[model samples]
Target: MNQLSTNWVLGHKVTPYQTTGNYNLVKGESPAGAQGPPPHIHKKYEEVFFILQGQMEFVLDGRQSTVTAGELVNIPSGCLHTFSNTSDESCLWLNIHSPKGFQSFFDAFGVPESEKDAMQQSLAAERITDVLKRAREFDMEIKIP
Candidate 1:
């Protein structure tokens, strides 16, 4: 219901929008070499991703796939997955999760992009640990390692 703001979340710039009980949407930009969240599953939500620029590498159910601009990936609920911007340049993408709630995770842990050193803080060990601790509250079963 409120306007979404952008935040630096785990080495990426994320803007969560269109959040509702039905679904949550986000636009993101990841710098080269940015490794996304660890492999995880959402037992109650299906996820989709649309790549807008550059390329991204994704692991879905143990199968690795390279998605490029204009490509899309659909991950069913309970699938094991993770992603990384493995290209030599930054990549832009959009994501959506059905049966909304995951947006709360980003909102709670993401550093306001407007902060002077948001990028640095977003990846800090302590901040990551805190985020990881509460991940399950948002339906995330993160695989730490």
Candidate 2:
């Protein structure tokens, strides 16, 4: 069988490419004080976050909730959502987006294998208008917080 090790995939100090999917699979791990993206919505893609370890805070539609290990959250398309680690330890989780295509989205907004560190920082700091424009180009709607 083909074994795709973690080292074989693209990653950053904050994240690791444990796996990807024909659909979308989030093999996410975060240290204490870590947080994911700001509140945003993908009008065309559904997402799910499965908490595997530690505790996290999930904010959706302005409501906040804490999720612990073994819990899974399903986010419908077009709903704004975000997550953060509030515990003192590292948190591990999976964030899966359905129907793929988010890889391109992620690459455009943050560090991908093809970009330099500075460029990645620029991508991460991208203006909301630019992000929205890219979203529009991708036929996805992104709502800023």
Candidate 3:
């Protein structure tokens, strides 16, 4: 079993706790109500979003859906999807990607800790493209909605 914790480190706001069996369970707490990762498709892992608190707007397969507390949404593998926090209150949620250990790719190719959050924001396209390429190395495909 592969287990780990990813700290936001400077306002990234999301902490990825552990990964198991194609599922990477990420805990995110954000007051800024910021946007999330860009739309992409996963070749090996299927993703699901389980809302623990507050609300989030999820766009899957180019369609829109809202997830509130205690709700969960499944995004099939190879589907494009993205999520964002649009509420006034802080949003907390779990991003779970199946077939786990996806972080291995991130830890290997992700930007330096200092530039992580900023890079995630400013270079959304490039960053995600790099991530997708890295994921490919691990035989993982990011599903796009």
TM-score of each: 0.93, 0.68, 0.68
The lDDT leader among the candidates is 1
Tens digits of lDDT, candidate 3, 10-48 = 234555664435466767675546666656667677777
Candidate 2 Cα RMSD after full superposition onto the native fold (Å) = 4.8
Ten residues in a row with the worst lDDT in model 2? 4-13
Cα lDDT listed for each candidate: 0.91, 0.62, 0.65
Clash counts for all predictions? 0, 1, 23
lDDT per residue for candidate 2 within 32-112, as digits (tens), equals: 776555577777888888888887899888889999999988889888887778779887877777777775555454443
- Worst lDDT run of 10 residues, candidate 1, spans 16-25
Off by over 4 Å in 3: 1-3, 9-11, 19-22, 105-145
In candidate 2, how many Å is residue 109 off? 4.3
Ranking by lDDT: 1, 3, 2
